[model samples]
Target chain A: MILAATPGTATLLVELGVILVGLALLGRVAARFGLPSIPLYLVAGLVVGEGGVVELVTARTFIESGAQIGVILLLLLLGLEYTGEELTDALRDHAPAGGVDLALNFTPGLLLGLVLGWDVRAALLLGGITYISSSGIIAKLLADLGNTGNRETPVVLAILVAEDLFMALYLPLMAGLLIGGDALDIGLEVTAAIVAVVTALGLAVRYGDRISQVVFVRSDENLILSLLGLALLVAGIAEHLQASAAVGAFLVGIALNGPAEHAARTVLSPLRDLFAAMFFAFFGLQINPTDLPPVLAIAVALALVTAATKLATGWWSARQVGIDPPGRLRAGATLIARGEFSIVIAGIAVAEGIEDDIGPLAAAYVLILAVGGPLIARAVEPLTRRFSQLGRPARPRRTPTARGTTVS
Target chain B: MTEINETKLPGVGTLHDFESQSGGRIGVIAHHADRREVVIYDSADPDRVSEGVTLTAEEARTLADLLGGTSVTKRLDDLRQEISGLAIDWLPISSNSPYVGKTIGETELRTRTGVSVVALVRGDQPLPAPGPDDELRAGDTAVVVGTAEGIDAATELLTARAR
Candidate 1:
């Protein structure tokens, strides 16, 4: 009998299985070394990428599109977890110092991009992309380090919330500019976004309790389906309005925040996690190995500068706001990790042809940040302790509580 | 005398005792006196009580009453006592108020409001671990803890001075 060729479906199944197994093994190894598993996952993607021995993911467009969805869902979860009060608190806490941090990180990236002969739009995109610290990696590392309940967790979360809010506002504006759309069109888009958000909030306020009681209380399956449906519908509407689908998804998540919805998140989380993994894997597939060495060098350099600037800016801000030395150091170290959203911005830039060459660079930067950011965060405790000893007498230790614990 | 003698049982408080002893029990007792108890006894044949041992009219009536009524007044009273200590009062800072963006120490809030800012519920986040320098933002709901007068003063100041 003639040997049957491996069908695309079978090949995909085999590749996915191998990639997942490799990722799990690598993640375990990384955990043993006290590093976050995200870096391992990224490395695994690199191994199975086109440049590596195996070619598991060959379609860059499909992978990128899937990754984009992952980022949208990630942002939606973030919005769901935070409310207007929480968001405002984050802004207040970070506004005084985050402004400086943003400037320091953005300025260097902009200068570098310009020096490299990049266009204005490209330079700004690069700058903005580099300016953000990976909140996801940092938060994960903090939890891993058993600092999730630390007093500084909320502060770091607040800072991240501020950064994300800025990103949500900035992304659409950037898209409008690069699309060469008219001012009136952009204005109308912005107004429509505002109206959509208000309507979503109004629906949430009016019907949230009843909806939660029916959907979540009745059965978890219903809750998951309803939430997923809401996310997709909102994203679809956002696309229709020519705004970022991620922004719409985020607004829906924000509107859903309450005790009843919070309970339902646990059931829905596994699905989000699955999609999120696929998203990161897709991002990994987009890297062209031949372009990596030079891009990696730039990524490392930019990551270093961004981390330093973020730390210094965060520290100074915390100090200005009268945070203790330990608290400031913790905040500084924690704010250094950057992840999916940065890549999304880079991908957007590529899609719009604003600076096609910068996508790989931005992706490389995210990879570097994901790898190195956790290491810096892990060192914060020892560093803070050392600095606290050198400084004035340490402040009286507060008893640990749930509401404002510091994450590593 | 019979009622008094029948009121005591291990793990059975005044509420349960009253319900057991009366068809419909209703009464109050000192909080501390209602604490849980444990009973221990040695019996050659513990199950013999159900084998038709003769009992006086008083004993039969007490047992019958104990099986009749249903009352969980003790638990309800405990819940009430716990809730009484959790009074929360909100303070508003009016638009023309002088306390905008000021810290607790800067505003001398303790002196002016006569209430301790136990927590700050700003939007969706609650600052249960608020520091002395945590600046007050507009529309912050300060969870003040104090007497009625203190709560009123804090509320008035918040209303008068909040941005």
Candidate 2:
């Protein structure tokens, strides 16, 4: 009767229902296709977004908020997977090689940005995107290969840790730069953010177990609510403080310990997955399909150069540890993927109204490597192995286990 | 057991990890005398926990049964042999177990195996020192105390097909 006269909640509900159902079906298809569902989700976003098939007039606002949650949860889950203690120790141990890694892998993007005649900030953003590798894809490759006992894994891990540690330090700095303050203001903001993060980290390291004891309760509902609520609260505060909500959520995740950590992860993973999908879609939604064709050539060429540089970074780092040539090759191949962090950097930059080209370029570059990374990693083993065999028989090395890196 | 690393958490417990056949680390927290928690690390990120499963002493036995393969598992018997003298073990009664729907007294578990039911665990709740008059439900864990021989007998009796 009056449904036609006024905009009702039913329209929003129906749209959301349709979108969610579509996402589920796409997720299943992606699983079957052995893709990460990220690409599929991105495509879905592009199709549903502006200048595409269907424009959702009602659900756009809902999606925008969901995307923010997605980014926060993505970083939070990642942080929960890694702890503060891990980061500090990794940074301390791998500083020199990590330095080499930064110099080599990061140079391509910076040089490319300069060549393309972008401003310093955008160039830096581009460089940041190029420097970081995708831990998510590499991790999956490691698991799929079931070659966990390989000699090169620890070396690869050291490099990954170094990258992760760098991101933790670099993200707050980037966020401050995005705020467009003068030198002193930027420095002060960055310092405050770093100090806050470090203090929070120190507290987590010292009082994590005790915090867990307090957070856990007899009821599952209370446990999840408290953990999610705390993460959101930290993220909000971090955003207000200009520390980046991702960092805040991540810190909250790393801070949780013991029984609460396990329970919280179990409860929060579904929500994280949901939001993470939305985040990817939102990223895709921002990119105009028309802009993609022009960026395609640069994206492919940049991916190739970065892929080579990443290989060089891995080769040099693993070589520093005296790994065999084949192991070095494997290490190089494994580090090729660039997924979450690159997109995140671009997202933050775009949010600050940086060059529009940055987003489409990043989205294109990530799409290339996230798909190609796995294929290359899979092929590298046999490729390197057979090549090594052609030269001479090699003995399996019994290397000492990596120190301070007990997976447990 | 070779210790990969040890951390002493003052009020909580001592955490010990071991290097598995794979490069990943597995850890156990020996908490409050008898309680233990098993931890598995994320292979890709050694700093974070991939999984942490906290099982009570009662639930752990049910886990033992599951990991033991089938009910009449050779490994479970070998596990009992490790505990000399008076031994305690948890035996699971599946949905279709012969002893289901009968009182502990009627099942004559003690009569057959010379083992006493120390407790009965149903889900998270453990009924300590379960009386013989208590009914044995499906998916119940019978916590029996006995010698290795008695446990083997109980294991056989619990898993046998219905009469």
User: Chain B alone: TM-score in each candidate?
Assistant: 0.43, 0.58
Candidate 2: misplaced stretches above 4 Å? A1-8, A394-408, B1-163
Report the lDDT tens digits of candidate 2 across residue range B109-145.
7888899998998988999988879998998888888
lDDT of 2 by residue, A1-408 (tens): 665545547888887787788889998996675666666777777777776577676887888899999888877776666555656665666677788889987888888888889877888889989999877667667656643334455567667777866776678877877787689998998899888888887887778778778888868898878888888999999889988888888777777766777677778889988888888777777777778889999999999999988888888877776766777888888888888788888888777777878888888898898878777877886777566656554445666779987745
Q: Which stretches of model 1 miss by more than 4 angstroms? A: A1-6, A57-66, A148-152, A182-217, A392-408, B1-163
Best prediction by DockQ: 2
Ten residues in a row with the worst lDDT in model 2 chain B?
A: B73-82
Residue-level error in angstroms, candidate 1, position A89: 2.9
Reference-based lDDT, residue A40, model 1? 58
Q: Is the docking of candidate 1 incorrect, acceptable, medium or high quality?
A: incorrect
